[model samples]
Target: MATLNFKHLRYFWMVAKTGSIARAAEQLHLTPQSISGQLTEFSATLDVELFRRAGRNLELTEAGRRILSYAEEIFTIGDELLEVLRDQKVKKTLPFRVGIADNVSKLIAYRLVEPALKLGEQVRLVCREGRLASLLAELSIHRLDMIIADRQMPANLNVRGYSHLLGESGLSVFGTSGLAKELSGSFPALLDNAPFLLPGEDVAIRPKLIEWLETSNLRPRIVGEFDDSALMKAFGQAGAGLFVAPTAIVDHVCEQYKVSVIGRIDAVVEHLYAITTERRLTHPAIVAISKAAREDIFGVGKD
Candidate 1:
């Protein structure tokens, strides 16, 4: 196979960014034919088609999107290098990329990651939110430095990673003022036959919640289900139904969404984990996050 060509890669990146060979040619001060030939050679070298024609426009293929992500990082680093060499006082900012599971409470996620930004070192924090499986895939490829999730990495997954328990928080149910008034009963009894919003089955808490409801013999009317915790809270805030959040962030959730707490369920606990490629946490940002979560946020040591 031919070695990678930075020149061809640069041309391909420009074409991808401009969405047209002609536009890229104009920007690079080159002929359209020259840009087209470079892209063709680049694609052939990579053994993948980067773009597909869509009407009069070009759309990136899956392979193209993946390559574009790398290209963006490459060009960003190149620009930073130039700045550092050109200016003696300039300091390079360390990039800390974290993947957050969608089902994790947004407030809890923010609190867990907030400490990393406060660290003395200048850092560029990039947070990507998605499903656990998808985020784990990104982490496996070294695209993400760490992943924050409700559950630990599954044993069945082939990815090699260590799960560090951040801390656990009991569940707290909340509802709009009207709903709270309407369902005025003591504790779990108030939840019986009450309209409820809940996390989808894909969320780690869903199964535990279901089991708890069944054990309590409380059959709440299921009004809505959500894969995203934020969306579930939004619906709950609008008086759609009652929803549960981690007690660790109950105050913030209530303040932000203007919801009232219906009750707390200590039995239905939520556990948070930080999954990283390293068995022992060593990264400065990661260490700061772990320390803050245990000492401040959750107020408990690792499990």
Candidate 2:
């Protein structure tokens, strides 16, 4: 009904994300009562209830959902404005929030992200790590500028954007020395009678791993089914079970744990890809960073 302030939009966005005024206030470092007051004022001005209580949880009504979409767009535009203003030599410093899949090792992800942070004094790089699906969802909603993910993300993944495959990289099975010693020969044979720390059934890699196990006539004694590779490695390091991970991650795990590379699987090479919206592709910073990443960082030539 009236021109809204940026703070109101920000508060609204936070509440939409957190689903609770109290939690949103905590995140924004404002009082819950203040947030409630602002929301009340906003609702009155707009002549609509932005949110309603569904028991203890705050549920967004239709009006609230519509307004939230506009808020997201406004925030994106605001960020573009800041980027343009900064490009004019004002030296605005805002971190570029980059997301990566959890399948990537922490060490590898950090290595890739750290160099990108050194691009400019004002170019702060914020890394958000999660599974491929979650990272892509965040990217679609403009919560992330770009994401490093597997190439398996389909063209019809509702991305409504462009994605570039970085390159193919090898991933392999690895386990601690204690676990490795238990294996008779190659990985296929080791599956039987071994305590296995495996990815969850829903994971993309699960079917392939299952097929591989079946071909070897090996049925692993399942110890855990994890979605988190780091946690899998932790369990493996503690001698709970053997973990199968990417070869790129093997060296790092070996150094940290008593792990060894028992065997390598080159056929199942996982690909790295960079994904971004068409609009964001034109942003100077985005263009520069993507170019640098392709030409130097994770570049095929470099690899």
Candidate 3:
């Protein structure tokens, strides 16, 4: 057998992590045709079929599943080796590239992560706001050291990555006192009949909200869509429509804009998660920040 090529391992890793050739290709910035061909080449070199279709999706064959275990172990060791080599040459403060989901408020991000600067270790914290899928892609490539997400964890997350639950908070329906007053009906009935200010189409909020509404058989009439949460709250405060936001934002809007929290949408509870590549987890700086998040942010006591 020929020696295993890094290209084959890379393609296989992405496929296993994303669970879809199409999605993994998008993440890797490669054509689906190219990814498929590379995967085929990988399997051929190994003298085995790696995966087979299961309905509309693909699942690992028995041989593929066995290979996955070894692949994960190899990748982790490879990453750790690279980190050690880089550290010896650079000798700078340890750097951690972190990502946060857009649904999380800026204030929440500041509150949760700003304390990391207090740590004595030479540290660099790089933060960005984006959706879960993109953030995970950056993690897979090692562009980001970790991610903090409020929702939308991908189903095919790589085994070489790990996750920690930071906290849970419910999302609520909020709007100007005038909007709530104008509805003049029970909370459930008002939600069914009132105009709603919502995040634009293609945002994760839309699907989750729609799912929750369907369960109640209540469909809201959307008046407008805005990408900025602050602007959405402003429109809601002016009695334009009801807006969905997290508790922290709702609390802030209530005090600043005098918006009323007509009712809490119990179905929309959000969970915060910290995700990191397996190699980064063992570092002292990553360990410290993760500890802070789990304890201070999630209310989990440190071991």
Candidate 4:
């Protein structure tokens, strides 16, 4: 009903998106009191009740929800406009937020993202690790620029996203030096009754690993199951059990974790994908990652 102050609208939008003014303040780099003052003024200017408190969180009122819809659209369009005008010459660093699925090896994720940093100082990389479904939810809401996952987007998800195959690599079984030496006998046959650390059922490679083990007629004793690949590797490094990792990072893993390769699982490959909302990649940082992954990073299985 009155002339809009977009600055106030932006504060409100951030608060609404984040669910609390304090959290929004943290993201916007402002004090909570200052944001609260701005929000009070904003509500006064509009002569509408914007929020209602619900426990520790702020619940949007009917008017607030309506306003948020417009605010999100406004900011999204504003973002698109800025993207179109963005240039390397511009001093402002563009934020590229990526979500890495927890099951993905940290070594592989770092390699996939390292190329983006080497491109230039113009990109600000922000990384978050979580489950693929959670990351997909964030992507659907535009909270994440992209997600790194071991597989393609599920066909059942209602969220719209494009899966870009960055690269794929076969896996390798690894164990501590002493453990590997002890188990060194005859390939898959040596795996029989060997202490094995398996990926959790939620992981894409878990079933593949089970199938491989069964087909090879090797029944390794399950030492533990882990949802976090890095943690699983740590267990393997400590001689807790043998674990599997992407062969593309075999050397890196051996050096970092002080482990030795027991064998290679070339039949079961792990595919990496960059899942984004756009079918065509427009983000320069992401483009660099894709190029590097396909050309240099996972170009060949290290095994």
- Backbone clashes in model 1: 0
Q: Which stretches of candidate 3 lie over 4 Å from their true place?
A: 1-94, 156-160, 200-205, 226-231, 248-250, 253-258, 279-303
Q: Estimate each model's TM-score.
A: 0.96, 0.69, 0.57, 0.74
Instruction: Encode model 4's per-residue lDDT on 161-264: one tens digit a residue.
Output: 99999988889989887897777578878999999999998789889889988998889999899999999998888999999999999999999999988889
RMSD of each: 1.7, 5.6, 10.9, 6.2
Compared to the true structure, candidate 3 yields what TM-score?
A: 0.57
Over all chains combined, what TM-score does candidate 1 have?
0.96
lDDT of 3 by residue, 121-173 (tens): 65667676787777787678777777876654566766357776666666788
Candidate 1, which segments miss by more than 4 Å at Cα? 301-303
Worst 10 residues of 3 by lDDT: 89-98
- Give residue 142's error in model 3 in angstroms: 2.0
What tens-digit string does per-residue lDDT give for candidate 1 at 150-253?
A: 99999999998999999998999999999888986799998999999979987888999999999999999999999899999999999999999998888899
In angstroms, how far off is 257's CA in candidate 3? 5.5
Best by TM-score: 1
Clash totals, every prediction: 0, 1, 0, 0
